[model samples]
Target chain A: MPHVQNGWYLAAWSDEVGRTLTQRWIAGNPVCFYRLGDGTPIALEDRCPHRKFPLSLGRLDGDVLECNYHGYRFDGTGTCVGVAEQQDKPRAATRRFRLLERDGIIWIWPGDPDRADESQLPDTSWLASPNWTHVKGVLPLKARHLLLVENLLDLSHETFLHPSTIGNAAVAATPIEVTTSGPRVFFQRRMVGVQAPPFYEKSMGLTGLVDRWQDGEFHPPGVFLLNIRLAATGTEEPEGFHMKVLYGMTPSTENECLDFYALARDYAIDDAELTTFQHEQQLSVMGEDVDALEVQELMYATERRRTVESSIRSDLAALRGRRVLQKMLAAEAAEESGGAVPATR
Target chain B: MAPAARTAGDSGQRIGSPGADEEITVDVVRRRSVADDVLELTLVRPTADPLPQWTPGAHVDVLLPTGIVRQYSLCGDPGETGSWRIGVLREPAGRGGSAWLHDHAVEGTELVLRGPRNNFPLVDAERYVFVAGGVGITPVLPMVHAAERAGRPWVLWYGGRRRSSMAFLEELGGYGDRVRPRPEDESGQLDLATVLAEQEPGTLYYCCGPSGLIDAMRSRCQGMPSGSLRVERFSAVPQPAVEEPDGGIEVVCRRSGLTVAVPPGTSILDAVRQAGVDVLSSCTEGICGTCETTVLDGVPEHRDSLLTEDEQEAGDTMMICVSRALGDRLVLDL
Candidate 1:
């Protein structure tokens, strides 16, 4: 999909960046990332010009990124400060990206830096507010970024996929709807006869009745939040049933993704309890997804199918997601080709 | 009239950094019985992948076949272009890294190793005092030899349970009168204070020993100038028991929404791992900064020797291994 060049992309959680230069991919290109003194994110081309060594193989000197191969130092703009071999100075500057920090998330402009917009990043005002706790983690997923984006949008799988936690056995889909707004795609799941799963049973206090279910909306590239509620009075009684899990999926590579999350809910759980609970849940779900999807990727490599088909109604949101992504990718490819016929019709 | 800077301002002056060394398969491995407990492993990399050149204080990160990595000091001369030398002290209570090196690893087995990075180096000093204890002598041995070659006034304070326990007795004797091999020289222990008293004005006191010796020297050498005293601790200092969390507390991993209960004996690190969070950690003993995690919230009982008291008090850093949550629970920025 076409990535917004100037718009913020989560580079890494603050905890992930340290003295060691870590390599991450953005928009299908590898970039080595490091943190500045105040935990600001900096991104540069992963390859060092001295010997084309991976810059992540280097070290961090305060704000300067040092190439591990020959101690070449590059500032935030990615201009080579010092090359160990003095004779190679005439033509040795690496490409630099526009890096920015909002809250604890690091963002990089992988495309045209001239058009990057720092203001477009999702408002993380919840991070500053009281009655909310946050935790940060980094997961190196062996799957395409689009695959992860689609995975989050397809929330119906949770009934079977996460049976013990966020799932329910009797929560058959009564109706599934898809709607779209500018830069946002909404996926709503409605379960008619849903019984409370054991974990949520005690937590929600809806032990007997059909606890109403509605998880809506998937904001493109990567942002998923379900305006969920247990008791469906149909109008405004859906207060305590909703949780906002804003996720940012930054592409690490063509075959890897870095998922950053911020969970804000109206629960009275203490900071420690909320933070640890969400962290543990994310880990379990991520482990399951990583195992299943990496294996799927391996299988996809070997099996080249001529045609793939599915009933559109059963999983309409997933299908629409793929179509929207195809359109974005086509537009990007056309722009790259100077307005030629796009990659796909 | 500009004052000459005592410390090197530029990063260029930080010597003994690792360079581009090709990954080589182990062509040969030789185990030597130096002491009753110590085992020396000599790994020969391919000629094409020439061993990474190292200085005296440098160590290598060895990747064993079992996927465990351990850092060991280069005991043999770093100047040697041949195989690299590392002495492994078989820690009985080790989490299988060193114990595997002592028991199972053998000759002709291929291995991956990261080289010769030196955080502890013998700086330019007029006179050197090398104080070593047990396997801690690995780094000091090379310093003793370098001091002897430079004709720099040096004394070796080697202490162990007995004379046989010392790693490099043969090399220490070459120093002649400079070597004070204190196996049991009587007078109730090799008093490091007595050794520090004879220090001249320009003398540099370098001590690589157990935590007790390093702590004692550090406390006694307080009056010495800042750059005069250099200390390296091989083990941890004895501290109070880590305060346990009350009951089995819930750790709300905010990013994931999964709650895991951390049992009394089990550490937060283990609990995090159990929940399947991928945290990069090393030297679980709290010395190395590999397991250094950012503290998002909660008062971290700083058990690690890596960060200073100020860093701990700032509530931003923590070592995952030995340290525990002081309050009911701690929310780590994983």
Candidate 2:
């Protein structure tokens, strides 16, 4: 939870938090989720204010959650409704976080409720659009959230990390343009005449020398999107297979993250065989990233020795991503020191 | 720090993208003040390749060294293929677009430019009434010359703060009686109402000026013949207050067969990019004529300053960058 970014973060998949007291730790804080009688989702601080007992261990009686420890009951808004043997409930209440559900994902804001603006959230309609098909899963990375963010921003790692699934030698060799417009950082690369990677050739039957492009945009803290396009060489118009690879990296704890990823495409929205192949291939590719990042984090957190690292031209986007994160942290730190913002707790 | 989520995609999604624009690199051969605040620059290709031919009322997007793009009318002779000329007015209140050229554009300076796009084209007419206000005369200058070459009867009403602040007087010196200099210091405002009332059977009015003048002309034009008035605005027409939700409207691209949900924060240009259809775009600011899409149905709230009053009311086409639907559904010919 670097700098505790002040906006909506994906707490779980839309289907992951329903019909039960689902508990999820996001950015170092615990939250419990449940649905009302009408199917509207709700999230509240997991800890009971009385004895600090986890509210997720309680039972949902219609819309109120009855704490298991002292039998205290709370409504969907975390308002203490019943105190077991009393009527007033001793002014006991738990923090209620704002939640918004869209595109098969549920987002929770772990900050000031008045400042939780939904427009700051990313667009992921393709994840659930009838016009596009996707294969998605949640990867529990034993690494910080920024590790996933940097990994996605610097995609040259694909050539080494997942060479068998979606990478090629041309990836590391191709040059990319790194630019920034305010808080947004962009990495764009275009290859006019190159052999299609084996993964792409077999997965989509791409043949012959082709023109390919990789465009990346990073909106710091939680989201990263990569758009890929491929077309035959000498084609006047760029008509080809397109992909929008989306990553919703949510900080679950200080040392771990819940990385939700989905690969949505414009073509083959109705192909069942392709969906199965993509699901398996995605698991394999993401497995490689999770394994690599887990080992990297082991070295980063446990090692007594610190090693110097050198970056090349390909690190331009990653470095800019780091700079924006640092800038946000610095700005937030300044704001906190000035004592203008309300306390999160 | 508040987090913002933007799904990154093709380079065409950039705000500065001269997408599919015919870009030309030319060196400034000459720069001279044509009016009190107007500067004229002559550009020529260093390699002597003939530039693309453009008609009268055409303008080019000058990508200044500072990355600010401003459109200027091509006041030079369209017959000359080796060189191009443009007139720039230093707008004191503008966003430093014209002032950048006025201050930094020098002879021998290399610059990048795009397009000779024409939204205010000069069509054939038996008689032409050319109404130009201040530096708005740049496009009118070429139109009047084209009319003379076509042997058509044309009269130019050139109005400005004063004669010293008006451009192309020397070029109009030979066309005595046909050219009327209505400098405010001497002649008061040109009675556009009188000109509108005297619309001859075959007369077509070509007006290029500030919003006030263009609006006045548009109001007077309704009583006159339809399709008889043509206006070019130097800036965007003021849009009404935005009151849409953040969830966005649904845009269906008929030709591409792609449907996209355009959230309020995302532009229609980027939304179309999500469906893998990159509509050609230049200035996403609603001024440049690129990224214009045909509206099949649904009322489009025209936010662009490019379309004339009647064109907006007609509602056949829209600038996708800054405009959206009046309801939850919009169909576009991508």
Candidate 3:
């Protein structure tokens, strides 16, 4: 492992650990999982310090995980408690990772634990609030997580790759605007005379609009949000619109990701039906993304990276997103060498 | 991290409880379609995870990518740590979470599961009665199995529009004389009165299904002790029609300090977002409980339909989507 910088790598979803020593490989190391009786998720090295046997093969006793093979027990912090034979050994321990749960995802810092910053973790407070009806789903892609991230940053492919869903055949000619910032990238596009899909149409009604049309933004490393508005009939000051946000965090494994999304619509806040309608609509849109992304992953795995030289204005966001990611990666490398990384355009 | 900021009415405070925040990944050793539409997904992990663990009478939320988090019942043998089992019913109304499992998910799909967390777990009782309707059988199905294995006397009143819609019919038969399948009944009605009248002393009644059944059961079980009868509904209660707005209002998001004017034709959430507050929301229908936040000051017309009488009485929370302030201005915890 290339001493991953002190950043958050999604360890597991809040739904993924138990007392049973669940196993997952993140960044590169294998992690054995456990949770306290009160339901706090934790991760420790998979290899037993004693015999190198995978700790995942063990069992859990209350807050402690008991190795099945030799009957060794360890707590949430990865402190060793019992040895099969040498029960009173002074100091036998295993490497433990720092795990934090935020917005339904358990994040781990598999690097220098002291350098872990809880404040740097991504915020997902929307998932818990009742005003939002959100769903957190998973998909194991065939391609590497980095490739998937790249694909997400690239929006020009929608013209060809997702022609049937969000992309329009005629819209390919439209130019896109792209921008880049520190560890963040933005892709923007403006289209005319585009038809609204079910998700958009339904959400428009809830937002107190008649017919709604759209605009979009794709942020780097897996955050996609779109701004859609109501279609104008007579054009009387325009009704309303919304910003739907989708974020994907790929896991320790190269092909898996935890997708977090939220659809903030414009509608009467008190109308229950409108909220449910938005939820159902967002669900369908997510399904569409899953169908496309999973297949995209499969195709990338089967074929070499295709030349992406063709540039459209709308693709600016995707390009900027890529540039930002490259910058972040270079900065990380420079920091490792005790040198400041120069900012790039 | 101010202590006052973490007070009871803190809008940012976690309502999912401390337990609502856990996630566990278990390997699926075996996954089989036990019924036509029902699949028994069994997650097998080393016994290091505790056994006879927590999941009481409700479902645990499973996190799947593509932004899908679904709730499923713990149908497998709850007593065994060898595996955790759940029965998933694919609904046409599914938002890809359950549909993905039905179409794409299979055995060996590593499941990242959260608590067998029961906002609706089973409680101790002298006698137990279970009423399951359609996929609502998820939580009850396992309870019946446990009751049967433990030699506890319980009857399963399972209803479906037709026999085919009801999952685990074969399993229901295994309940023997205790199960009453209501497939033939007109509109598949469940006579909770008849069932409740025959209730034995100290009997605990459990009902899971559509709002109608739950409402019916709740009314019929009125004679039972408070909290003696439990219920789990798949969908939220129906919301009332929104009347034509009399006037526009103003919303102030406490955290972001953004204020927006919500005209009669607009929702408070929309106005707040327009002001760049960027509040997180979903299912703008007010049912999913995703946008619920603390009310700092306002008589929120209390529009959406999810909270119970108790939750509303608590008045510490309000669903921002599809709900609005009764007065001209409202302050929110955001």
lDDT of each: 0.63, 0.76, 0.60
- lDDT string, candidate 3, A12-89, tens digits: 667766666788776667888888898878788998877878989987777777777777778777888876566465
Write down the TM-score of model 3's second chain.
0.64
* Candidate 1 chain A: worst-modelled 10 consecutive residues by lDDT: A306-315
Write candidate 3's Cα lDDT for B114-227 as tens digits. Answer: 655554556556679888877778778778777776677788888887777677787667556788888744544766666776867877777777656766675555434445
Best by lDDT: 2
CA shift of A134, model 2, Å: 1.0
Candidate 2 residue spans exceeding 4 A from truth: A1-3, A85-88, A236-238, A339-345, B1-334
Model 2 lDDT tens row, B1-334: 0000011111111122233266789999999988898889999998979888888877677776776666677899999989999988887776677777777889988888876766567888999999988888988888999999999999998889999998889989999989988999998997887666566789988887775787677656654544677776665311111124334888889998999999878988898987799777766777555677888766576777555346564456788988876446678898
Candidate 1 structure quality by residue, lDDT tens digits, A191-270: 65457665556444665655465665555555555555665333345354555666777766566777766655556546
Question: Candidates ranked by TM-score, best first?
Answer: 2, 1, 3
lDDT of 2 by residue, A9-73 (tens): 77878878777998888877888888988888899999999999999999988888999999899
Q: What fnat does each of the candidate structures reach?
A: 0.00, 0.00, 0.00
Better of 1 and 3 by lDDT: 1
Instruction: Please report the TM-score between candidate 3 and the true structure.
Output: 0.42
Chain A TM-score of each model, in the order shown? 0.84, 0.93, 0.73
Per-prediction TM-score? 0.46, 0.52, 0.42
